[model samples]
Target chain A: MGIGPVAAQLEALLFVAAEPLPLPRLSAAVGLPERQVRTALVELAAHLEAGGHGIALSEIAGGFQLLTRPEHAAVVAALQAPRSAPLSKAALETLAIVAFRQPVTRATIEELRGVQSEGALATLVDRGLVAEAGRADSPGRPFLYATTRQFLEHCGLRSLEELASLANLPPAVTQVQPLPGWRTPARGAAGPEAATPDA
Target chain B: MGSDDRGGGVPEKGACQAPEPGLESVWSGLDAGTLAPDDVRVEALVGQQREVAADLEDATAAVVQLSRVLEAKARALLPTPVAPEAEGGEPGAEPDADDADLAERVAAYQAFAEAAALLRSYEESRALRFGRPQPESKTRRPAPSPAGAVSLEDLLTALSQVWERARPRTRDVTRERLTVGQVVARLRTRLSRLGSIEFEELFPSDADRFEVVVTFLAVLELVRLGEARAQQPHPFQALRLAWSGPEAESR
Candidate 1:
């Protein structure tokens, strides 16, 4: 219905932010508690929607940003605003694997694709769709890659859970099954499964 | 629902359909001593195999479908191309190159000069972009100063020294690395419990070479501070430590 002063201040911040601002960051910036900031963000989103504003409040990449509505995307593009290039087929496939089986190593991705995906992996990382989650405890301690929050924004997903549900896979298929001679997905941090060396 | 491609695209006339073996026909065959029990068993096994194959195919198709959906979503989310800027000047206001005004002539000259400079910059930028990735290979060193500012050998030597100094040092930041204080605490805990422990027993089970070194240092500090005594009966043997600190005396 109506936005408060907190919501208005949040709107200005979101509008100017190049990247999404997380709740904690927003709270710190506004000098308010996170709970109050969250409430204001909700009110701001509602106000934008009700007012039929060209820019809408979007929770993307684990943060809030003011993004042009989908309907106005065409008009905004017509104004010569910068937009990221579309990913190649190979890059998309690599992204999908990273999204589905996160904290995965490059060797696993190559094994699944049956081809070297270095270029695609690099491109995904360059585009901010994927990032190094951590290193596996196995031999060589290869860096594990996972989809970033930007990945969720790109796919219009709220969370990794949303991406998982989108597949509508059977419950059994959802569980991480360790391949032969491969360590389980959980690495380090006293994980339940024992580490298996590469065969 | 009844008639679709689920029949594997067979015609509705059923001309290609296989003959069905009715239960009566089967009984007649049995009475006539024509059909064997093994044949029926074989038929059942074949059907089971077909069902299993279908299930496998379904699972495969589901996975393929999921991949396709993810790819489609990714494609849909791609940012739209921004429209190109329209060139200035009205369509009807065409300038004749043969009889141009002074203003147009100077403008044309300036434009030509600008284009040349822009082209050179574009080439230089392209070269830099391509060359950026090649330095990691270390196959080719930076080309000597074109103006012969210094000998190639001297330049290479100096640059190598600078590079060594400027290169960022990386360290393993995993939680596995132990601090000196942590090793000291662990030693104190075990010593207080057992009154005395061998040097080998001071190290934790997950101790790495670094941790082993730290643990040794901690024990040396305890002895140096007159808080513990190290007794080795023979050379190259485990050193036994007895706590004699203020905490131990109070206990």
Candidate 2:
């Protein structure tokens, strides 16, 4: 199909898609050339703007999706009851370690926490609180975790520095002397179940 | 009577010559009248000289003793580590000059190393306080684009791109259109209900009053097209938007 029809078809596809669809997947689903799909998305985005419903089609995180205008947040919140939950202790700890020790492996997290955190990590991923930022440059090249924007939102932070200040938390264990100079991780430390103080 | 006797005693022939003119004259001219008793004066001067000499000797001895005492005290009070080179040498053997110098250099280096380590740790701690790691450079390089050069359009575009990239997906299958008015209405409703929203999505652009205008229009358009939806699942929670479906009408 030409750019016009391809753009129209892609827009149609995004309009019905449940989730933000990756460009490759969208291209495959529409059975159109990738370049054409990209051009169509741009054109369709402009067309959407021209129509003036305030919504726009755009690509995010390597995917194409439709989103509401930002100014409408309060309206949406009123219509849909907020379902967000405060971060769990384990999630907080995991986020901290990831922020301060970014490009760190899961094994390192286990070492710091002194326990297996496979389940907690999964929960964080499901919540979009953390993501596989990249692979470590070690022997195994293990997947490394990092806090996502969602994590920042949960903490009510504008940047990592804001979160870092929050980390001056009391140590998980009371009796142990908190490392005199250790700053809390950028995301704050976890509780005893997920964190341990140095002996 | 004494004068003639004393004269006769000096020498019999000389005494008899009656005091020759020159000799008599010289003796008569002498200042014996003003002189103290010669014997007593001599004895007193001699005694004084001896006393001075004795005092000098005592002072010198005391000075020497004081110097010795000071040297001993200094040796005792100053820390004296065994010289590394000297420890292996015999009592009479002179230590190697090179070894002594090396030991001094090593000690100096060790002191320097300790000072450097302390400085590094101090810097690290300071960095932690400000929510930063130790800076690799003392000053940061300036950004490529000067802050003054950034226009409102640039900022809005950046913000828009970020929102486009970072927003999450919705689980529902029904598409919704969002317009600027709809979005504003949604936010106003949510705010009146005391609900919060993702702060980023709430103010996604840097365009002053225009952002509010544009985004409101955009959201209403979105609602009309059925590409997105406003959500408030709870009273205390903030309003949020989610992708409803892909069947949203084309704008």
Candidate 3:
């Protein structure tokens, strides 16, 4: 019931967890009330900060997680193997658009880039950076995509609200201009424009 | 060819008469009432018979070519008859005899298919070269769309249905009980080779919660036995399993 033991238990659970741990799961695991767990989390964060530990406790994606401090990221990368290939420029741009204008359809992303972006969109989805938020109520019921929790973790942000303002983005990304020469790889001859709304 | 070269026709029948050069004259002769309907019908039959003969000749040539290809394939499939080697040679000198046989079989089939394809393509190319004018690649106009063209939305809907059909039909299978010992042996073997692996990677993607619990128990068992060590480098990270054998300890 003490804060010290609860904090130790929270730290162990967080260390072994593959994803961020929510308050409910943490409380259930420790067999303590949610209020006690919250206090312990604060205690643990303070303890880690005071002790100058490489790992820091942070709230991310609506859950508590232990993540390596930004200062130690370089050393950690040197130790850990690369998880996967870095996202391409196109994929990153698409991710940024989704993060900002979320619940947005593929058509909107293409309009922003001025190029066909199905490939980049698919890559982001595959990497778990973006996910289907839902279908648009509009014609054809196109799938609307948004940044996922993994995206926040990847970007080292706590939530969508913490995202860098759109003003920071380059003018090319914010403006709409259809690219003439660039073409979709799979079906270049028949672009997205060729698709018509279903009757 | 001239009517004379085409051979003499029956004099009684006007259509069969060797009276003119060119098919136009023959048609004109019919239209002018110089040739009777029966004579024209007889002439048409003769023309059809000649075409049939030419087609038959081509078909026979194709049959012969196919037969030769089959014969070669049959010969290749049969095991080669090896003669006795000189006394100095070892009997089992060929270590990869089975592999070699498999490779030969694969290569033989590949070569057979390739040779047949190449022959057909070569024939087609020659016909194209002599029979018609080559198409201008750059100047070629795009083909007109067929009437009632399906939109991509329809195509995607159809594809979704096809994909739905192509999916493996899930059957209601009874859950099998996974034992801790089984997972321990499996984990130990993997750890011995990999030296270290992430805990999340221990189980398959589709592993059930029961299986995961059993596997976690097995991991604890290995740790208790000093066979493996589990550590998490950072919070929210997967537990890393490292082999704690003597060599690993020294390293």
Candidate 4:
């Protein structure tokens, strides 16, 4: 195929891809040389940048992907508002572990929670709530996890201490009173019909 | 009472009796009026007990005083330095440029010190597990023997042979060689990463001395020979000398 057709195809593939695509994989899919694919990607990225659409191609985690410019994050967040749910209980628990036991391994979280937490961990990572800090020195060298700055912003904390203090209640109490809004009914307040007997 | 005096003391009625064999009988024979005049032993025992009590009280007082003095001295010795605060209501405000720069330098130094300490401990532990090599001076080079002992020239030839054997059998190969300029470049790059030179450690023998000119020059020479590489990941980080050989690529 000519370079023009190949570049068009590459752009189309990137636009619809849910995750970043590696150059090798993209080359294989498009049946083009790796060098040619890279050149095309560079050209495409520049074209997008100059277009002023607030979307740019980025290299992350060894792959190329399109991402919204950070300056447009507020607008994107507003558009995504109704689709989002309040933080799940499991997510909160995982976040707590990440915040306090930061630079901790996945095994440590499993040990503390007494259950498999892979799904919750992945979810937190996907949401940018946590990140891979580094690898531990032990055998197999598992990746250490830590809460990201987004997590701090979400929790309304200027620092990790504020988050840690959430778990630092005096030992005398067996149960803690939930924060004021946390105790509200999972569903919106009972409907008026439920409060009154049916006619 | 009627007194019947016969000579000096017409043997007072009780005294006239023979003294008893034991203390009880002797006490019974003695008049109660005369006993009080001979109570010297009781007074001596009481005085001894008083002296012992006073000594014990003095020792305890001395111990308490010593403890207080020691505590005060300890407090004076290591008083926590008060952190200078910016005159404002904002807590944890961004530090001024000078303070920020100093803190960065200090943090870098602390990290380097910690890493060096860890490396030293690891080396010590490894040495303990595996016996250390004897001093180089103790091992003497063998004298060359005809057709028996290898001479220095022969040794060099053998080393070259080994190197030739190890060379990769591929075209378009990149031969990594170290040069003085390369070493200088690496050092400059590494120094940029390092927080600052630890002048004290670099020149412990001379306090007034600041820079490490000669030692650094020697390091550059070593790096030029491919014996060492300067490794530093970030600014304000410590420079590390690492051995880079063919085997190191695997690591």
Candidate 5:
């Protein structure tokens, strides 16, 4: 049959939304319970898919938004605009590390790659793939970085769960856990569990 | 000293300007024909010549000494054992010629490597035109991390930052607080029962830090408006507050 009034309202609201709209906000606006609104979003996503519409609903960036299908990228490119140039090699590697080990800090990345990654981190953040999640609880309050939903979209992964395990890399990669300069990756001179002077 | 030696020696400015008394007398004798003696004039001229020759000898020795010192210094300044290769290159080239060459070679190699990679990428991408425009997704690049010359202080700062971010954020859940108006009303009610009350009594045991602060402020405001009187028994003592009479209120 036709789309229900609640589902139709959700579609219209999401279409007009510039940012992702959470279920609670959508439910509040539609005067329905959050569970009902969530079910409606599910049915709405499926209905759009069944109808073979160019636009589809996807939950991203902690909320739901309408996006053009991947098959329509070339068509949308014609309608919208060309994508920007790709990130540099340094940026890609940094992004991979961030995507795999999210809520990470630049220091930790530097220790792992045996390099300073401020510039790469900044680039990934600018591209909207990696973002500042929060400040670490340690001194200087360095920002903790996490992969954005845009990161998954960029990688063509549905979620972080789909990220290929970095476990395949040397046992050393996982051993480089969080700490001061976390000096184990490059400077594997010291044992991974070596204590910091302050500790 | 010979009389002819005067002409051989370089003349001194002071000697030229002012002749010696004996020489002047000799010249005057010659000019005025008073002494009428050519021998005296010859002797005086010989004496002056002798003096000038001695001064010239001393000056020449000084010049030789100064020349020797300057030559020694110049020898010391010359880059000893200058590399033949450096000398053959452009005159006054940078001392570290090898470093400069290495830098140039590195830059050229980097350019060539980048161009080669681009050519390969272009060929690879041309085949998969329909694929998503995700750049460099599968092709892993070597980590271009620097010499990881991180200092201990920097590492510690970074470590602390990591630890701090990982620390659980104490999400302070705030509760409803009594406003100044509410505190004032409550204080007034409390004071009505007891004509005077201790300042500490305003804060009930259940009162949180915020409530205590608000209650204290409310008490100060009441006293400021002359609505109440707060008196301390002595310095560093608990303050007692009472209702201000009409006189205190008028003030």
Candidate 6:
């Protein structure tokens, strides 16, 4: 079918594309100039908003994509009740560090989490979420890790940029966490329940 | 340790003198001729026994030290235990919890990570795009290769495999005559009759890099205009190219 409007053409491309569409690529795909495409994208975002559509345009990672509004997270979650369990707390934290501060080394991640994370790092690697982006310039040439495209897809993010403006989630718990001492905090009454799954 | 003062030989069995109670087993351990040394002097024997005892004590101490080190290492490898109040605590001050159950912490952290990934997955899947649907899982069952059964990755990989193989020079030889345009025409004709052809089978066994490159570019042209499509049943498997439709006549 012929592209009716420039904005509609852009939406059609983003809708079918597996990843976010950047300006140049969108321009090439739609046979329009980059400047014109950029303006059309803005108009498209406003168009979706003004029309009160369920989906809206967002700038994430380094491209433009269409995603549902945040207000519909609950309904969407219900529709897609978690298929698998969440990753370990360590994996999640490691993922957060990799997502935000990518091209980082194990040493940097360890420093951020305040704990040795060989196992956690290994788990993330095995799961295909974290990957060795490259070797660091420092001594011994330690491997630097970064989140993979699979990670972006897994997190439901169009791009890393989309992850930036999230409001509800607390900052990744990077501060070196205090470990439970031998002296029970006089508060493990539910310790069995909470620690069982973890155990 | 000192040189023997008396004869170092043992007396005949019947003529032997009384020995210390604990030394009875030690004496019997020596063979009749195997006593190789004399037991006539007790002081030297006592020194030897003391040396053996000290060696045993040293070995036991080493083992204890090694076990302690291993325990410390095992503790260090475990996940950080939950200390909710310590969320924003000191930066580098890591606690040494003597009773930390590392396995438990790892398990807890694992659960937490799984939860995060699940939530993240849900969040991203929002406003699901309607496009080409993913291949059905039931299709994962074994099936013979058929038309329209090939995946996009397999098709691209086959093309890439040809492209990558063409990059490395097999030998020092230079003879270039074909052009991308000529090869494109030849490729279109070769694939014209056969609905599809396996990537490698299309070429002669002796086809060199140059010929392959020319042929590859032609294939790219044909596929670009939807005149032809490639198929691959599995990644890196044989690649096949087929005409897009009956209406595809040579341009």
Q: Show how many residue pairs clash in every candidate, following the order shown.
A: 0, 64, 0, 0, 9, 18
Ranking 1 against 2 by lDDT, winner: 1
Residue B241 lDDT (model 4): 64
Tens digits of lDDT, candidate 4, B104-206 = 4333322222322332332232222211122344223322221122346668999999998895787796664544455455554443445233423333365
| Tens-digit per-residue lDDT, B176-235, candidate 1 | 657777878778777877778886777778877887888899998888878788888789
In angstroms, the error of model 3 at A68 is 2.3
Model 6: residues >4 Å from true position, as ranges?
A1-4, A70-85, A114-116, A126-128, A149-199, B1-251
DockQ of each: 0.01, 0.01, 0.01, 0.01, 0.02, 0.04
Give per-residue CA lDDT, model 1, range A1-199, as digits (tens): 6779999899888866765566777889999988898888889999988998777776644566776776655566666433345555456556666666666789877655445778888987776567665677899999877765456555544555544554543332234443343323232211211121111
| Candidate topping TM-score | 1
**TM-score of the B chain in each candidate versus the native B chain:** 0.30, 0.20, 0.29, 0.19, 0.33, 0.28
Per-residue C-alpha lDDT of model 2 across residues B1-251, encoded as one tens digit per residue: 01222221122343453332121121222212221111122233233334533344333322332333233334435665444455766553665465455434333322222322332332233222111121333113211111122434558899999999996977967553545666666655544344334534766566567666667676556556665567877897877765443432321
Error of 6 at A42 (Å): 2.4
**DockQ of predicted model 1:** 0.01
Which lDDT value does model 4 have at B168? 77
The pairs that clash in candidate 3 are none
Give lDDT tens digits, candidate 4, residues A12-130. Answer: 88777754466777889899888888888878787777778577766532456666675765666655432223444345545555554455688866654444668778877776566
User: What are the per-model C-alpha RMSD values against the true structure?
Assistant: 31.5, 40.8, 36.0, 37.3, 30.4, 28.5
Classify candidate 4 by CAPRI docking class: incorrect
Better of 5 and 6 by DockQ: 6
Local accuracy of candidate 5 as per-residue lDDT tens digits, B1-251: 11222222223445663343333243233334443332243434454545643344333322332333233334435655444455457644555565345434333322322332332343233222222233464223222121232435567899999998896778878787679889888877667656678877778889888888888899988888776888887999888998673444333
Q: Write the per-residue lDDT of candidate 5 for residues A136-162, one digit (tens) a residue.
A: 788898887766545544443333433
Lowest lDDT 10-residue stretch of candidate 1 chain B: B125-134
TM-score of 4: 0.25
Each model's lDDT comes to 0.55, 0.46, 0.57, 0.46, 0.54, 0.55
Leading candidate by lDDT: 3
